[model samples]
Structure formats: structure tokens, C-alpha cells
Target: MTSGDVSLETVTAAKAGDRKALEDVLAGLQDRIYSLAMRVLVNPDDAGEATQEILIQILTKLSTFRGESALSTWAYQIAVRHILNARKLRDRDLGLTFEMFATDLETGLVADPPAAPDQALLLNELRISCTMAMLLCLTLELRLAYVLGDVFEMDHAEASRILELTPAAYRKRLSRARAEVIAFTSQHCGLVSNQAKCSCPRRLPAALKSGRIRSGSYPNSAGASVDYAAAKQQIASVVDDLKTFKLQQAVPGQMCPEDIRGRLTRMLSHPL
Candidate 1:
């Protein structure tokens, strides 16, 4: 995704019908594309499907690589468009609002910790799962902005180009999205807000009984973990609103699903 000459060379080689070049280029993009799709759809199955489709489109349209943008930007443009279309066909609404969630916070939700050490291990797993799932409440557009800006650490100007918005417009959207996520998490997530009573342990039992968290495939934060005390201090800082978003972003939830790259690569080998 770095700028300058290497990107152009890769695109040029891939376009010129170097099979290895095409494979290598696609290998690099598969996970990033899948990650974006997962944020949009909040389902690994859907994200995998979308990633394969997007990869095919990018490969087939390589000749149109105009160099006006980085290949990553161009690829993301295709990805954003495809994901938008897919979302229209899928369920795109969360039906819950920050206002609704804010109201829920007043009830003081809490859970009893598991007595056994084995269950304690599972509790950690649930924390990450719930953290990732919380993102599903955001509208697809706002979620996309947050993922692009905060999670992926993309700059506003480039993110604007990817989302096809003016830089100022993109900033406005990202700011609003960041604020909503921060406010909700601060009031509802135990890790983000120490005073908040809602912790993953409280929800783990229900999630397990419902078959949401399976046996071998334990959920994880995917990126680094943030200490609750540190996060709490950051949330209380002067610029806490913005700082909270960055802290949460530091704890990324997941990347692509397992075997996605292999599945797509095999599928690609056969035909269009």
C-alpha cells in the first residue's frame, strides 16, 4: 500500500499478463479487501464472498489501471462500490441508536464472573468477540468511515478519495462516527469506561448458551490488547473523545476469516 514506484510496477506487471505478478499482487490484497468487507457486512462468510468477487473484478480490469491513484486506492474504490451494492441487497440497518444504547446504560448491566479457571479463559475470548460485535450497531456508512480512518489508520484525504467524498466531507463523517462510537463505548463498555457496569463476563454465559461462541474457534481481538486501566486514564484525559477512539482502534477486533486466501486462490485457479 506504500506510494511511489513499486505499486505502479506491480500493477503494470500484472496487467502485462505475468501470472506470477498477478498472483503475488492479489496475495497482498486479499486480506485487506476481506477486512474491509467484514467491517461493511459484519460477517466473515459475506466478507469472504465479497473479497473473492472484488479480486476477480480487479484482476479482470487490470488494464484500466490508470495510475491516477495507488493500486490500493483503486482497489478500495472497487471494494467500497461492491460492498455498498452488496449491503443494499443484504440487511443494512442496525435498528438501534446511540440514544437507545445510552438509555440502556442507565439500567446498570453487570455479570457474575465464572468461578472456574477454564471458564475464565473463555471470558477473555468473549470480551474480544463482544467488542468486535459492537461495531455491528453502527450504520454501514459510518462503520466504513470508522474502519477506514481509525482502525486502518488511513489518512482523511486518501480515505475521502476511496469513499468518493470531498476531504472536508470525509472529515465530518469520520468525526461524527468517531464521536458516536466513543460515547457509546465509554458509557457501555467496561474496558473503555471503568464506571460502566457492562463487562464481557456478564454476557459470556448467554452467548455460550446461544451457540454464538463455539469451541475451537475462539474469538479474539485480532490486534493488540489494551489494558483497562490505561484505557480508562486515556478516556479521562482532556482530549478523551478523540483519544478514546484511537485507544479502541489500537485494539482491532479481527482481520479476515480463516482459509479465505486459500479458498479464493483455488477458486480463481479454475476460471473466471
Candidate 2:
């Protein structure tokens, strides 16, 4: 049968509460759902639990689906809600920022004469752990916005519909999510570090020279070398503008920590 025929069959069987059909549907979509969950939860254990919960929810709610949207869309919506609720239950501090999760997985990967076996193993584990952690820091709304837009490559309108947000609101959330990812990358991945000479705009050439960043290649769950040159440039421009503004407000000699904190708060409060 064609793909559509198969999907229809699965839907019918799923509605009829066929356990094998439910299992088939879950198996078919497991990787996509798992990857999205991992990206949002940033923790493999949490992602796995969320994935299981999502499958269970899909099975239970399959009959309620009224054909208002495609089966995939309905599945995505359920997964998104499951992940969001899981995050809420775990993290009481809504102020939890994304910076805490972005670790430098590429560290020591380019050591001289190649890394020793243990060092190599450690680096590999770090990459996997860091990617999982990064997914956990994102807010539910931002995570859904990113997964649908970036991973699925859905257009803004389509993403908005899946997310149940206005086009403008979806765009705004997407922008914020992108910014958070950029900032988290810069802070955690040593994307802007003086030690490796990998700071933002300058890191692209360095990363290529060291063979740390690959183009058009996808890495499995562990981590992939990303083309962050453009993202870095954009984020760097924002950082530079902020730095310039801060310098402009400086009164030369006396600086108070509280005053600096207040200024930083104000800067962050401003829209990008």
C-alpha cells in the first residue's frame, strides 16, 4: 500500500483499539518523537519517559481525535503537552534559564596528536550528555515552536496551527527560542571562549580548521558539529550592541555591583 493508505489503516486500527496497530504507530513515529522530546527535555531519561507517556496518551486519546487535523499533527500536539507538563512538574523555578545546560561537548576533542582513548570517550559522552541537557532548559512553548519550525521545517503558518498560536505570536516565540538557543550555545559550547579562540564570529574558521564543525552532516543522539557561523554573527551583533550601550552609560571610575546588575536586568528586559 501507499504511505497514505498505510496511515489510514493505522488510524482506523488505532481507533478500533488494536494493540498491535497502536504499537505500529508508536514504532513508526518513535524516532521523530524521541528526538523532539530529547531536544526539548535535554535529558535522555526524561525524554524517554515523556516519549512513553506520549505514546500512552496517543493510544488513550485516539478516539477523541475528530479528524480536525492529520494524525501526525495530533500526535505532535500530544507529545508537546506531555513534555510541557513533565517540565512543569520537575522544575518549580520558572526562572530557570537555558544557560545552565549548554556544556562544551567539543572540548578537548581537538587535542594534539589526537586525544587518548579515555579522553576521546569522555568527550563523546560529554557531547551526548550536553545535547540532552540543552533540550531540558527550553520552555514548552519555545520547545514546540522550535521542534515544529526547525526540526520539521514547517512554515510559520503550519507551525502556528499545530501550536495553537496566532501567526504573530508563533513568530515571536520562535524568535525568542532561537535567541535562547544561540545564547545558550555561546555560553555553554565555548562558542565564545578566549582559550580556544572560538569566540562567535571568529570560531567558524577555527572550528573548520580543527575539524570540529562539519557542514551538512547529521550526528546521531550524541551531538553534531553545527554551522554556527551565521548564528554566532547574529548573536554577536546583539552582544556588541549591548556592550556599546553599557559603555555609553558608564560614568568612568565608580561602579556599584547593584547598579551594574540593575543595568544588566534592564538590558535583558528590552526586546531583541
Candidate 3:
């Protein structure tokens, strides 16, 4: 079915209490819903729970929907509110002050290495993940503005309506969010540069003269025999660890603070 037809059908079935139709609607929109939840919650587990809650809310409240907006938009509204509430609960449960999370993120970035020239692809993925994690710490108003405007590429007027804020208010929130993200990226870039300077081997020319440079068609003087598969596996592990860290942060209830700390310690002990 075309999107419009499917939407209309879902609405009709939803109004008639057809559970399968509701499921179909949710299944069709799961990616968008999950992406929004993940962007706001910054943890898979929390995002998963938030997704479930949002789906339930959509089903229960389907009858109340005035049809003033598209079903997708209305569902998005519900998802956004659910994420906001989940974040609040997570913060309260962990006894975490927003300042603490922000400080930790700042400190983590400082200690992180710069993007490797050869690892540019992996680094870009990490950068996107870091940006999403940062979004989790933003206020709901700002988070919605950023996700809708920046991530989803929504127009200011549309975002304003979704956020139920004046265009000026939305603009302010978008401005703040953009500024925060840019500042974070700038700091991160500095950290990466410093790390590369410190850790990267010095005197590639001298190394080549000494026959220490490996025979590789690739640049960066890496040996052709370099275990790219192993290296990739290691990077994947680190990404997984980071994902777990994000999940812990997003859903603290899933793991005790001590458990989270231990996991982080182990991850750090093993260098990326």
C-alpha cells in the first residue's frame, strides 16, 4: 500500500480496536521511532523500553487522536514525550546531576584519541555515536529541536508545530543545540589531533630507510600483512562496549552503578 493508504487504513483499524493493524502501523514506522528514541535516550535498552511505552501509548490514545495531523506525526509526538519522561526517570533513579554527565563526557573526549587517517571510516561512525550520546544530555525542548531540525531535516515551522513551541522558541532551542554540538565536535577534534601527534610513529622516512616500514600498497606505512580482520574485530568490540555504556547510561536500572563502573573500567583497561 502507498503510505497514505496504509496510514488511513491503520487509523481506521486502530479506531476499531484491531490489534494487528496497530502492530502493522508500528512495524512500518519502527525505524523512525527507534531512531528518535535512540537519539534522545542514547541507550538501546532505554530506547527499547521507550519504544514499547510509546507504542502502547499510541494504541491506547489512538481513539483520542483528533486526526489534525498525519498519523506518523501524531505518533512522533507521543514518542517524543515518552522519551522526555524516560530521561527524567533515568536521571532521578541514578541520582545523577546533569552537570556530572556533561563533565564525564567532556573528560572522556579529552582522553580519547584522534581519528586515525587510515581509520577515517570507523572514526566517522564513532563521531556520529558521540553526537547522539551528547543529545541524550540535552533538555527535552532542545533535544526535540535538534533531532527534528538537524537529524530528521525538518523545517523550522514543522519542528515548531511538533514541539508545540513558537517558531522563535524553536529557533532558540535549535541554535543552542547546534552550538553545543559544534563545541563538542571542536573539542573532540582537538583531542584527536593531540592523540595522533603523541601516539603516531615519528619519522616515517627514517623508518623506511631502516627497512622498518612494512611492504603495503596502502598508505600510512602499515604492513600489507597487517591483520585487518583482527583490527576490525577489535574496533567492533570497542563499538559494542560503547554501545553498552550508552545503554547503561540510558537505562541505569538495568545495571547497578558498580556494575556499570566495572564494565567501563574493563573497557578502558583494554585500549582501543
Q: What TM-score would candidate 2 get against the native?
A: 0.59
Of the pair 1 and 3, which is ahead by TM-score? Answer: 1
Model 1, range 97-192, lDDT digits (tens) per residue? 666754543343345545434554465556555555567677777878888998888998889999999999999999888888888877777656
Q: In candidate 3, how many Å is residue 1 off? A: 10
Q: Return the TM-score for candidate 1, rounded to 2 decimals.
A: 0.81
Per-residue alpha-carbon lDDT of model 2 for 1-272, expressed as tens digits? 32222376777776786656665665555556666665566444555666666766766677787666666677777887676666554574244555433223333333333333343333333333333345446776786787677556678876787787899999999888767765555444543333432232222333334554443332331233322333234334555224222211111111112332233334333321
Count of backbone collisions in candidate 1: 0
Give each model's whole-structure lDDT: 0.68, 0.52, 0.52
TM-score of each: 0.81, 0.59, 0.58
Judged by lDDT relative to the true structure, which candidate is superior, 1 or 2? 1
Q: Pick the candidate with the highest TM-score.
A: 1
User: The CA-based lDDT of model 2 is what?
Assistant: 0.52
RMSD of each: 3.5, 16.3, 14.3
The predicted structure with the larger TM-score, 2 or 3, is: 2
Query: What's the lDDT of the predicted structure labeled candidate 3?
Result: 0.52
